[model samples]
Target: MAKQERAVRTRKALITAAAEVFSREGYRTASLTVISRLAGVSSGALHFHFPTKSALALAVEEAAADRLRVIVERCEKFEQPEGPIRLVVDASYQVVEQLAADPVLRAGFELGGHTVEMGSSGRVCDLWQRWVASVLEHAQGAGGLRSEVVPGHVAGLVVAVTAGLEELGRRDPRWLAHPTLTTFWRLVLPQVAPAGTSVPLQFAGS
Candidate 1:
C-alpha cells in the first residue's frame, strides 16, 4: 500500500513538473531532463513512467483533458437562479478561470493545437462550441433567447471570441481574468437574451 502511494505521488509530481516545462517551453523544446529536475525525481523514474518526451506530453494532454472534463461537468450540474443563458455565460467564465489557473490545461491546449488529432473533449474549441450550442438551444426552447437570435451563430461567435481570448491570454494573463470576460458577457448578453429577460451580464463567482 505504501509503495503504491509513493508511486502515485511520484507520478503526479512528474506530471505537474512536465506541465510547467511544457507550458513554458512547449512540446518540441521541452526536455525530460528539465521536467525530471523540476519534479525532483531521477531520470530513471521519469523514464519508468514515460518512455519518451511524446509520452510525457500525451500524459499531460490526457491529464489536462480529465481536468477539463471536471470543469465541464461542474458547469453542467451547477445551478443558476436566473436561467440557462446565464448558466452558459457563467460556465464560459469558469473555463477561462480554469485556463488561467492550470498551466497544464493551458499547455494541453497549446500542444493539441499543433496536432490535427483531437484531444480529450474533442478539441477545446469544439468542446466550448458544443457546450455553448447546447445551452443556447436550451435557452431558445425555454423562450429565453430573442426571437431573432440564432443559436448556431451565437455558439460560433462565443467559441471564436473565447478562442481569441485564450490566445491573447498567452501574452497577457489578464485576458483570462474576470474583468475582460465579464465585459464581454455584459455587452453580448443583451443581444442574445430576450428583451427584459432578467439575465444579468455579470457572474457572481467572477
Candidate 2:
C-alpha cells in the first residue's frame, strides 16, 4: 500500500513538473530533463510513469480536463437557479480563476493550441466549446434565450471570446481577472437573454 501511494505521488509530481515546463517553454521546446529535475524525481521515474513527452503532455491535458469538468459541474450545481446565461457567465469566471491559479490547466489549454506538434487530436478548448453549445441548446429549449438567438452562434462567440482571453491572459494576468470577465458578460448577457428576463448581471460572488 505504501509503495503504491508513493508511486501515485511520484506520478503526480512528474505531471505537475511537466505542466510547469510545458506552460513556460511550450511542448516542442520543453525538456524532460527539466521536468524530472523540477519534480525531484529521477529520469527513470519519469520514464517509468510517462514513457515519452507526448505521454506526459497527455497526462497533463487529462488532468486539466478533469479540473475543467469539476469547475463546470460545480457551477452548474449552484448557478442553475439564475438561468443558463448566468450559469455560463459564472462558469467563465470560474474557468478564468482556475486558469490563473492552476498551472496544469493553463498548460493543458496552452498545449491544446499546439496539438499538431504533439500529434494529439483532443483539445481542451474544444471540450469547453461543446459543453457551452450543449448548455445553450438547453437554454433555447427552456425559453431562456432570446427568440432570435441561435445557440450555436452564442456558443461560438462565447468560446471565441474566452479563447482570446485565455491567450491574452498568458502574457498578462489582468486579462484573466474577474472584472475582465464581468465586463464581457455585462455586454453579452443582455443580448443573449430573453427580453425582460430578470437575469442577475454579476459574477457568482459579486
RMSD of 1: 2.6
User: Model 2, poorest ten-residue lDDT window?
Assistant: 197-206
- What TM-score goes with each of the models? 0.85, 0.92
Compare the candidates by lDDT and give the number of the best one: 2
lDDT string for model 1 (157-186, tens) is 887777777768878898988888878877
Best by TM-score: 2
Q: How well is each residue in 87-161 modelled by candidate 2, as lDDT tens digits? A: 887788788888888989888788886664777666788888889999988888889998899988988888787
lDDT of each: 0.79, 0.84
